[model samples]
Target: MIKKITTDDLRKMQNKEGLILQGCGGDLQEWQDGINELLANENILLDGSKFENCLSFECNGITCLLFPFEENVKLDTGKLAIWRLRSHSTFGGTWLSDYVPNRLGGYLAEQQKPDCPLIGQDGNIFNLMGIASKTLRRNGMADQATEMCERITQTAGSYYEALNIIGEYVNITSAEDADIDEDQGMVM
Candidate 1:
């Protein structure tokens, strides 16, 4: 079950029990063998425990492995450090519990609140969408802008629905207002 995931997806995860081996560069097979050897030496490798059972993803150009454990397990930090040094990688394995977010704080922190001026603009849905998409692009969220436009075009049922869809990606505001307080009844 070697699944691939983005760092954003990883950040949103909670209560995940696993061993993460990071900073694996170059030969992935060598890293896998090294990890297996380390685990076997530590008596952590069970009959089903293998490199194939780990989730694989790349973070910042380095490969990472997540060996998900159904039961609580512990690895020797001293030996893990030695393995990391032997592998010549700057980073090493850690309990996934250390990275798992216990609350919604991480997700909230990552949320983007790009503002769009929809007030007193052409009430036409396309025009409003263009404004919101441009705002998203200006905020360096061009992917989000594209996704929002696609979602609106495919799913919006009416003008109000289109406005609601636009609102999901950006804060609707007045073009004349430069410093509108978000706390002061700004439409979401």
Candidate 2:
């Protein structure tokens, strides 16, 4: 299916092999049809490629398309290039492999460290996630809390990985630290 994805979603993807058509403005449907027609004329459609095998997105106010190939398939870029140049906005095409997505770094830099009381709690991954989610929501970062939990559930493979994901969104305090803070509060 031609899924609509965001720039962040695109950045997170790995090993994507496709053609990216950018700078498509005005009627998106017309552009989609034109691409399908071009693919048909070039015998790409005869090779079992379909319109549903593409993805649509918007970058910098221009509509874009991603024609994903499951395996290594060479396409005649000459026709696509000419077709793009004839568009109203002068669309451009690029090999998906040319764009390198940063798997980490840029995303982690934006994370907030809300304090989460995880040390004294059950070591169950779900339990720790709950504590962290509540703490994040209390800190007015409910969206981030949800995203963090989703990442853990979707991508984390083991208990330690879940903890790592949780740590990305919150500061986990040890039981000893909590006790020390309480004791210091009483003395103060």
Candidate 3:
């Protein structure tokens, strides 16, 4: 079943998580406006301003933003048989400090990559790399954090692949033990 999230529920997730709005039933603009109104009714403002049907929100130190998404359904028939496939994909939501990377892009682009990380040949840190690096720094693993930054800046791959690799070194058992292994390095 689809679980409906309430404003109170969102408040509970403040600072701990952000919402990823998707699959609203409408055209693009209408969908965006729907989410904007839903959040506005909950007292969440777009960057603490009046509602302009924008995609990013800030309230009580919590941040929420919409990521780019695609939904595809396919049907194939061969040899008197038919096959159907349905898939949903979404990308580009990384928690960075008090906000997401590209709020403006959240309004304009199909893929919201405001400050998205560089991948493959670009060799720059973006998205999950930023999040993991931030997590490492907050945990007092400055050296490890530095190493993570360096590693991500030098690595090459898709966002999902890079996130999985970096995530290997970022296990958190508790507040006291973020469990970042120094010797393991940033690459898996």
Candidate 4:
């Protein structure tokens, strides 16, 4: 089932709407409004994050700006992204200093990453790489992520594939552009 994680209810929920994503101007609310407009019945590619974590939904069939999204945040799709978002902090809220996700999990509670990491084993990384490849390919990019993945798999092998894949992806991302396709506040 899909749960709507709002910024206000984040503390008391498991899933999140992923409203913490931000960018240069901090005026991304307009972009968010567009996404929110498509909640429930429709979905859209989340703008402003590097991972391309898009969510599809229209309104709740009710009249309200707060859209209820379900199962949208997958590993690379929309699931884990929102999971990671709960670990993030906004102007208010608490994180590592105030709380911790898992004992050994990363404590980016800082909430300042272009995108959340794909946290998992090599297999998970491979799967996530596929998702990113497909999303970017669908977006009409040059498919750089998959291209490098294939290269690494063929030459450096699978052991180094994840590292190389991540290395390649990281090399091209500038801080500002990194979060381009991520959730920069799902306002619409």
Q: Which candidate is the best by lDDT?
A: 2
Maximum-TM-score candidate: 2
lDDT scores of the candidates, listed in order: 0.68, 0.68, 0.39, 0.37
Q: Comparing 1 and 2 by lDDT, which wins?
A: 2
| Candidate 3 lDDT, 131-177, residue by residue in tens | 66666666555555676566566764665566655655575232212
Q: Measured by C-alpha RMSD in angstroms, how accurate is candidate 4?
A: 20.1
How far residue 150's Cα lies from its native spot in candidate 3, in Å, is: 1.8
Each model's number of backbone clashes? 0, 0, 1, 32
**Prediction 3 TM-score vs. true:** 0.24
C-alpha lDDT of candidate 1 relative to the true structure: 0.68
Model 4 lDDT, residue 2, Cα: 28
TM-score of each: 0.44, 0.46, 0.24, 0.25
Q: Where does the lowest 10-residue lDDT sum fall in candidate 1?
A: 100-109
Q: Write the per-residue lDDT of candidate 4 for residues 11-113, one digit (tens) a residue.
A: 3234443333222122334434544443322333343222223222222231112222345432233533443355334322122222223322333332221
lDDT of 3 at 70: 13
The digit string of per-residue lDDT tens for model 1 on 29-104 reads 6666777776777655655355455667776687787766654345554665466456545457665666544321
Segments of candidate 4 deviating more than 4 angstroms = 1-117, 120-125, 170-188
Q: In lDDT terms, how accurate is model 2?
A: 0.68
lDDT of 1 at 105: 28
